[model samples]
Target: MKTIAAVMAASAFLAACGSDEADDETTTPDATDETSEETSDDSTDESTGDTIDYPDLSGETIDVASDWSGAEQANFEAVLDYFEEQTGASVTYQSLGNNVATALGTQIEGGGAPDIALVPQPGLVDQLVDSGDIVPVTENVVAQVDANYAETWRDLSTYDGELYGVWFKAANKSTMWYNVGVYDDAGAEIPETWDDFMSTLQLVSDSGVPGLVVGADVGWPLTDWFENVYLRTAGADMYDQLAAHEIPWTDESVVEALEILGDLWGDETLVLPGGAQRSFPDSVTAAFTDPPEAGTVFEGDFVAGNIADQTDAVVGEDANFYPFPSINGSEPAVMGAGNVAIAFNDDEATMALMEYLASPDAANIWIELGGFTSPNQNADTSLYPDEVSLAIAEQLTSAETFRFDMSDLTPSAFGGTEGAGMWSILIDFYQNTDDVEGTAQALEDAAVAAYGE
Candidate 1:
């Protein structure tokens, strides 16, 4: 693995090379077809100045699997189209839906695993690595990652000190999407501190609009809310300790975070009419649709996509987001999730595709098409469709302290399973805000059972 210092030096060198390329482009005309043909055999194509010399994979066919559908599926297919155009390789994509783990496992067991799988959870990566079902990426891919990704992103794709995947898409979960018209009507300002956030909620409520709307129907959004608060108040060290079950959920830190959340969740006047019963999509639509139902909805950057697709709201105008408010004077912390492309086969075609996905060239394709964020630091932020999307992408790439969604790092039974563990406990807490102590105890019990502590 390359050290951070080595990565920094390489970045500077790449920047210098880019500057020189720009100068040459400004002074010289386009190369002749003959010149392009002559340099085609070289590692670096002089005609296009593309650094990676993709092999002619005319007869190769690679199969990829993921859980993406709808607009997300279309956006990723655009990326695959570019890879095929450049390398002459045919690609097949399979949408395994929400049960990707089960579907992929069945394929692997039946000896029919796809060439690449876009995994969404680190825990699943650990499973694949432990089972020896996936292979480490080539050195070419590693170089792209070191140059284009932050250390946290690189680490998320690594297991047992070996790199296994490339993070192609990222989600900034520490975003609070609000209706611009509603905020203006309520005379509400974006809050910076915890106390300010609470006051703003009250202010919005006093103006005849509910302060917040959350989708607690499936329980994952609630986990995101808890994660943002816990990450801010408890700090990163204790946050990690709690995620790994090293510290019991009954600790004072967990209780304090819950109590803070209760200040808003406990007050019915501050929440939308449905309270915790609202579905995720409904919550998003409610906040941004015409004649907005509430002041704000908290979720990931993907809320922008929902607003664009489901509602007629124009992003960056009718809808926008602020960072999840700072708490206890803590430094900015971003909670994020991403889909990592991991290879099951290390053939020439597969490795070539992996290298492409790691490059900014591939990331830029989907980024320009809207409703996507890339963690690749080398990607062009200016390509983002709007300022709000650009800001979210910048925060993801530039955050000094980034943590994956905590539930994503834990076992399925504890973190992901419906109506159990943290999900159930938080739902119960939402329904009965006075049971802060019981919520903490329930969480600890579930964590102990799930983690076998």
Candidate 2:
């Protein structure tokens, strides 16, 4: 079976992120000599005969675009460098950071899409496909993906039955990150059920420490909070229906979710002071904040880096996490997000990059660097630098199932920062979780209007 380029250099490139963040500075690092290894990037493939075709794309320059910066961008550059060395092609990366989608859309609409793009949304992939602008997935890339990833992941990058991209990087937002030291000092066991988790929070508070920190500086944290509780309480079918707007936000289950979250948010004693104004980074630092403002911070795995960059807590030993406890029986569902690698340019050099990115070869470059997660099951777990990385990988892979960000799936108008979206609406709810029904009705109104439009 064919895998991504086996550019056997004496050393693999370092493109992964650290607590230092992914650097956006583009690098066209020189490639290393190509040597053959008997191993394929996808270890699951039964056949590893020498029949794989590795194309030589020397002298061709391909441009890639993504919203990733800090360690993510650097990790990508390392992969590009390996691909460059194997195929002798020059590659440049553009880290659009937070403004990536708009910039990519502008470029695509203006007839200047990059050779390859890592899109964060399935809807965007569909949008590009519907517009007839994306370079359709070729058979070669499909072979690598089918061998490397699960059907769900493959479906995520697909439009209809046809594949449009590869899900490269992923984040597990189903976690509640906290300071291991604080949690241990309390001598509390990890709660397995939602009710018990709340009890645990109250226990922490009773111990003269704030139990939880809710940061709205980046409003999506609340959105994630709602998603977690909603899925756990209402079931996946209902969650999907709500996400698709098939059911109104005023649905009873939706109200229940908000109320459940309110158990934490509404409690003045349990939650940190001034949660509305605490930025995401501030929340990351809050537990480790000098004198310690809070004990637990819930968010995605990315917060590990923010914690490292802002504080000196060592992961696993000092900084650690637990899966959000389940409300219903069975495993609480995992709500997460990932990037789908898509191409707009049909040129050979461009398709090659897509093939390389989807392979374990590229993913491993970052996997080894830490502060990153790979859903590509074929990517070796041993490559992870620490216990924290291995544990997160387990959370991501062992999940009964995974979902991309719900907001990213909806219209940017309601789910996004536009008028009356989850961002603003959730913020309002955080400020006043008092009127559960009123807040739920407000969300439905916005959803109706946004979906109506």
lDDT tens string, model 1, 293-378? 88899999888777877899999989989999999898887887778899998999999999888876677677667778877666
All candidates: TM-score? 0.83, 0.82
The alpha-carbon deviation from the true structure for residue 325 of candidate 2, after best TM-score superposition, in angstroms, is: 1.2
lDDT of each: 0.77, 0.70
Model 2 lDDT-worst window of ten: 2-11
Highest-lDDT candidate: 1
Instruction: List the pairs of residues colliding in candidate 2.
Output: 15-74, 15-75, 16-75, 17-71, 21-70, 21-71, 22-70, 22-71, 23-70
**lDDT of candidate 2 at residue 346, scale 0 to 100:** 69
Candidate 2 Cα deviation (angstroms), residue 412: 3.1
For residue 331, model 1's alpha carbon misses the true position, in angstroms, by 2.9
Identify the runs in model 1 with alpha carbons over 4 angstroms from their true place.
Answer: 1-50, 55-61, 88-90, 96-103, 106-112, 275-277, 397-400
